[model samples]
Target: MKIGELVKQYGVSVDTIRFYEKQQLLSPSARSDAGYRLYSNADSQRLGFILRAKSVGFSLQQIRELLLIEDNKAAWQCADVKDKVQLKMQDIRQQIAELEQFYQALAKLDQACCGGALSATECSILTALEQGKPAQPETHQEDASC
Candidate 1:
């Protein structure tokens, strides 16, 4: 298939496909006499893999390594794949924890503000930000809450 056909079929932008080509993630099987890039079913499958890996937060380098393993599946070990997955899971967990902390801090600030014609100087969120501290909850319950 042609590059244009690949773009339409995958619902991905032409530039993104081009970028993947430049990154050495996807390569055309052949070029037509008219200079158009030509792809095979194998190339299409590789493109799908690249898109799916990226959607799940794999870096381009990681995707490239995965492609290498996929291309040489005869010598590939499942343990290597498991290691990569574990690292990704750890990073995701860390991100979630940080986001939860930010959410808690924001909630505390929101709860502190009454929002009745308060000036910027009196805004709890603004004051907390200027003080470089998260606003404390007005009432601390005995049980842990976020």
Candidate 2:
């Protein structure tokens, strides 16, 4: 099939498909006499695999590694694939923990402000910031007075 057909079937932009080609993730099986890219059924299945891997947060490099493993399934063990998934899960967990810390810090700052028509000079949040005080998660006070 042609590139346009593949784009319509996948619901992805032309640039996205072209970028995948540039990234060496997906390649057309052939080129038409008119210089248009033509894909085979195998290429369509490969594209699907790439898209699904991306949706699951796999980086392009990681997807490349996965594709290599997939292409040579006889040379790779199931344990190898499981190890990659476990590593990705660990990375995601660490990111979530860091984001939670950021959220807690922002929440503490938000709760410190009364949201009244007070002047900026009397803002406790600003005072805390000016003092270079680090957000202590254990010291979340409920007082909303500025």
Candidate 3:
């Protein structure tokens, strides 16, 4: 089989397959005399693993470590993999917390800007953003409520 055929079967583009090979997420197949890659059933199966892992939001570096861990599965058990997963979950949780903080800050700014047709120079949202948000903002909820 060829790379193109395997990619089509997995609903991925040919460039994506090549990129994965370059990224070390997929290994290159043996080449013929003319230097064309000769993909085998094993390559297809490996590609399937790469695609599924990517779908789960694993980073390329994480995927590389996972592939290394998987290839040495004879020496490593499920507990080893679980430990790695737990660490990645910790990193993801931190990111979610930071994003939520950002969202809440923006929501507060939106609340302050609900004031309709205020003087542009005195606009609370613009002023807070330009000067960096203060501990308190001008109250606009008194004027606009929905």
| Candidate 1 residue 99 C-alpha distance from true site, Å | 1.2
Measured by TM-score, how close is model 3 to the native structure?
Answer: 0.81
* Best model number under lDDT: 2
Clashing pairs in 1: none
- Which pairs, if any, clash in model 2? none
lDDT, candidate 2, 40-136, per-residue tens: 9999999989999999999999999999999999999999999999999999999999999989888988776775665778676787799977533
Structural similarity to truth (TM-score) of each candidate = 0.85, 0.84, 0.81
Ranking by lDDT: 2, 1, 3
How does model 2 fare in lDDT? Answer: 0.87
Candidates in order have lDDT scores of: 0.85, 0.87, 0.79
Cα lDDT tens digits for candidate 1, 4-75: 898998899989999999999999999999999999999999999999999999999999999999999889
Q: How far is candidate 2 from the true structure (C-alpha RMSD, Å)?
A: 3.6
lDDT accuracy of residue 12 in candidate 3? 92
* 73: Cα error in model 2, Å: 0.7
Q: Report lDDT (Cα) of residue 138, candidate 2.
A: 32
